[model samples]
Target: MNTLLKRQLLRGLLLAACLPGVAMAASIQALNYSSREVDYIAVENPGNTNSGGGGDSIRPYGQGGSICCFSVPEKWHADLKVVVVYQLSPDPTFHRETVSVPQYPDGKSGDIWLIVYEDGSVGAVVSLYGPSRPEWPGKIKGYPVPTKEYRDERRKEKIKREKAVLHSMENALDGDVSDLTPVELMRLKGAIEYSKKLINILEENDK
Candidate 1:
């Protein structure tokens, strides 16, 4: 081949070799906000803000419970949007809104949420409802929603965590309360109470 032909061929080969790596290097920008999944809460606007019901009517399928999805306020409907946050990725002190763990049953959404907590820990919430097997934009309509299967997995994991915590607290209770400092005793008591509450919730769901 002539000099120019050889140069062109070599360039083409190099470009082909780098194509796969370049593709792999690109990160998925789907805005998949999650926890360990992080404890992400789906705030209507932000980690805090208007997530709590401010009189907005039930969303798309409000009949099935808000977990299925909720609609944006009418004021913002013309340009309404549901931002699927991935994380705080910033200082919590500067934030005005907060992400709280939603109450049982209602909190589940197969979709991923990104938010920060008071302590600055990133929180992610997986749908414990939505759909059983969702396919993307098709499965979701006005707003993003998770599938039932995803929620089931999260529910199980939550139950496991709660049980583990309960076990530890129960074991601690077996020890002498006299040895614990006042503060330590107070925290232990609080944890025991919280753990039991969580256990009760999970058990109730099972029934």
Candidate 2:
């Protein structure tokens, strides 16, 4: 082959060899945000604003809120979906939630959510929330708190016997039974018998 023809052939071969690697690199980007898993983008505690805290490296949204969007690639809606979880203002007003596209008239559309928490910790309370799961978009509702019944202080006397039995059971597992102390062992035996009876009663009730 001539000099020019030889160079052209070499370039074409190199391009073909590199095409697979280029395509794989594009796929890696999608892997970072996949529909099979949930991703979290934590934000600063809105309760703490004295530091002029709202948006920063740790928090991406503004004082108002932050949003993330995902969608099905190539317009393929089946076996693939996109999820967008967002952070919204803690304010009770202004709908105080997130909503997704194709709010209605759906046949395999993406999902969206707005999660509101005082902080990004377990102890932090979740305020206003919204969802679009198994139905249309609307405020996510929660159950009301139930009242706890009062326990009299005099009942404390009865707990001592239970505590003693528990202690004996703990010691029994340590192989410290050399000092088995018949009184302690007797208490443990009685506790075990009572517990077995209670369990039987519960099983019968369940049935």
Candidate 3:
């Protein structure tokens, strides 16, 4: 080949070789270890369309399903950073921060995880494994721990549900059942009894 053509071919080959290191699109997921729900969380590299993924309303101590199409380099770089934007429960404001992406444990990229910590801090990790795996490389290992505030909120919700059930059952029993079948009346009475027992148990526990 001519000198110009040879150089052109070499340049194309080099570009191809470097493409994987430059950027590769991958899915992103959020794991919430915080007591409060994650109203929304997004991860992106500024000015780069290839790197953007987000999910909405990840419950406290819950894992969000993966979102598509975010760039993750095949190799980690010291200067690599991503902008994480998130909102938590009881806070109307959105929090933004630029966090460095931790290196992959084995130096190979897979899915990207955005972890929401108890203190509302955000962290980034690139790994082929989920947090459930022993090989996962997150700073906080294991599943989320529910906070006291979360536990209380859950208890209140449960009580509310139980109260609603009790109310409905009571109303059904009070209504005219002259035309009702025997089986239906018996079933309703059984449900009322169970509801009473459950509510009593819950009330005793609260005390």
Candidate 4:
């Protein structure tokens, strides 16, 4: 799980209780269930690494081992998923460094996010600090913030989708006029004409 996915999964789970569809009872159930699940996974040194020849991770969440934060499906099922693909990270110290096993081989203390899917695809992230860990853990606060580059990329995709829709509509206008009601036909034609005129005006202004 990258930063964006981590933040999103947590934020969604945290807000699940408040979402419209899920009943308040279910939300409360799920929230409590998730908390317990998190505690279960987090132990005093889940495992240790000796690559750097140090030892297994001895840091409990607050001190003994890593906090080891991760998420489960809102339903808390053994097989519920939330994404196409996801990856859990090792430790926050490794993000900036190489992935050598023996390099700083100590358990990490941070967050993990796992988004599982019905199809078995997943997305996940693990890190040391909140920022490096892909996302924060708050709904009101910033959790699933996309990077500037990611935002720009999404904007481009939106523009492309809009253009595709416009092109399809323009093509439909030339295809059939028989099935459409009079009012519908009139609106479609007017929209097409107005768009063409707008394009012409813009071109003229540019010239």
Candidate 5:
């Protein structure tokens, strides 16, 4: 083969090899509409961990940033399925569910959305658009709305954390601090005051 022809053939082969990887890559995003915070979400094909992706905690009524590079076929197939494994906050157990991949319209590929519902059921949809877009396929519309239960739980957790901080600060103040530099002593006193103020605010809100 001539040099130019040989170069052209080599380039064509490289393009062919690269195309499939580009086509197969996709991202996973979580939309937590549930009353509980989502601790984590992992998406994989049944018994196949190599080709999947996952993301960390998303607060109730919040959307998680995208986690990249899960495999999705360029062409949609009827038999396609992904296993979703996730956990909700305050719940020690992890849940797993097998979900069928929805068909993409017009052969379009998009990110996989894992929807966590208020009733604790999880659903998956493949969409090129996010919840803000009209093309979104999830049943609930717009951003998630936190239920009363969720709000109450959040408040309680916040108060608990603040109380712990106040207790720690109080204990430190009670200890011998004669060795602390004047600047350090002032900062410590300021932190204790801040902690007291936060605890007071949380307590008032609880009433």
Candidate 6:
């Protein structure tokens, strides 16, 4: 499964436990039931390829097998199972790398990242070494961080999503208000108002 879907499933499972007035006994019962239902699907490695092949940056290099990491679902920590399917290379030396995987907080995808090279040395990097963001792993003590590209990209995406939501609300509002039912109109109006509030907060934070 892809990262996003894995997160959604985990979040849903967690929400059920964190709800208000959930008694300890009730929570345990629910958790036990949920644990039995959760299962892990091994990620399929993207086929090996060369750097010159296709996947520009994020895409797996053609020469190396792709590694996708996933977190265990909440409540299933005791029964968590990890399965890896090995792909053999033409040369024995170009074999799959064995990684020491760590248990990540349930639901985060890729807490364990595998590094594969055509030369056959496989290494595993834990995101814990870095901050919550994997792209910005922990600093090298006093060494300066070369760039903030990842943070900038995150800001850009937040802006993009906000704009899209605002645009959609505006379009909905521009449609016939006369024909709109009271509930539908209220929903659209609330969305527009929420978008305005979000924009204001973002602008304030930017300043």
Task: State the lDDT of candidate 2 residue by residue for 58-108, as single tens digits.
Answer: 122111222221111223222321222232234222221222223222432
Off by over 4 Å in 1: 1-143
Better of 1 and 3 by lDDT: 3
Instruction: Compute the lDDT of residue 16 as modeled in candidate 1.
Output: 33
In candidate 6, position 172 carries an lDDT of 69
Put down candidate 5 lDDT per residue, 1-207, tens digits, no spaces. 666434434543443356563354566788888767799887766886543567458987888887654656667778878888889888878888898877774457788788888888888877787778776767776878777776777888998998888788778879988898999989989998887888788778777
> After best superposition, candidate 1 residue 128: deviation in angstroms?
30
Candidate 4 ranges beyond 4 A from true positions: 1-142, 187-207
Model 3, 1-207: lDDT tens digits are: 766434434543444356667445666788899878788897867555333466457988988886654667778999888888788988889887788888787787888888899888898888888887877889988767787777777877898898998898889789898887999999989988998888788777766
The TM-score leader among the candidates is 3
Q: Taking the tens digit of each residue's C-alpha lDDT, what string does model 6 give over 27-128?
A: 000000010111111221224221011111111221122322233233323333332323333223223333443444332333333333333333333333
- Candidate 1's residue-wise lDDT over 1-207, tens digit each? 666434433443444354442111110112221222222233343433433221111211121122322222212112223334333323232223333433323322233233332243433233334323343222222333444555667688889988887888888888777889999989988989988887788877865
Candidate 4 on 1-207: residue-level lDDT in tens?
Answer: 677445544543454455443321111000110101112111111122211110112111111132212332222222322221111123222211111111111223223332222232223323233422333322212232344554455456655655566677788988877899999988988877766665555445434
Best by lDDT: 3
Alpha-carbon deviation at 162 in model 5, angstroms: 2.7
Report the Cα RMSD per candidate.
20.8, 21.0, 8.9, 17.2, 8.2, 16.9
How many clashes (backbone atoms < 3 Å, residues ≥3 apart in a chain or on different chains) does model 3 have? 0
Steric overlap count per candidate: 24, 0, 0, 24, 0, 7
The better-scoring model by lDDT among 2 and 3 is 3
Model 5 TM-score, all chains together: 0.66
Worst 10 residues of 6 by lDDT: 26-35
Query: Least lDDT summed over 10 consecutive residues: which range in candidate 5?
Result: 7-16
Q: Candidate 5 overall Cα lDDT vs. reference?
A: 0.75
Local distance difference test, candidate 6 = 0.38
Give the alpha-carbon lDDT of every model: 0.40, 0.30, 0.77, 0.32, 0.75, 0.38
Per-prediction TM-score to the true structure, in the order listed: 0.34, 0.20, 0.76, 0.30, 0.66, 0.34
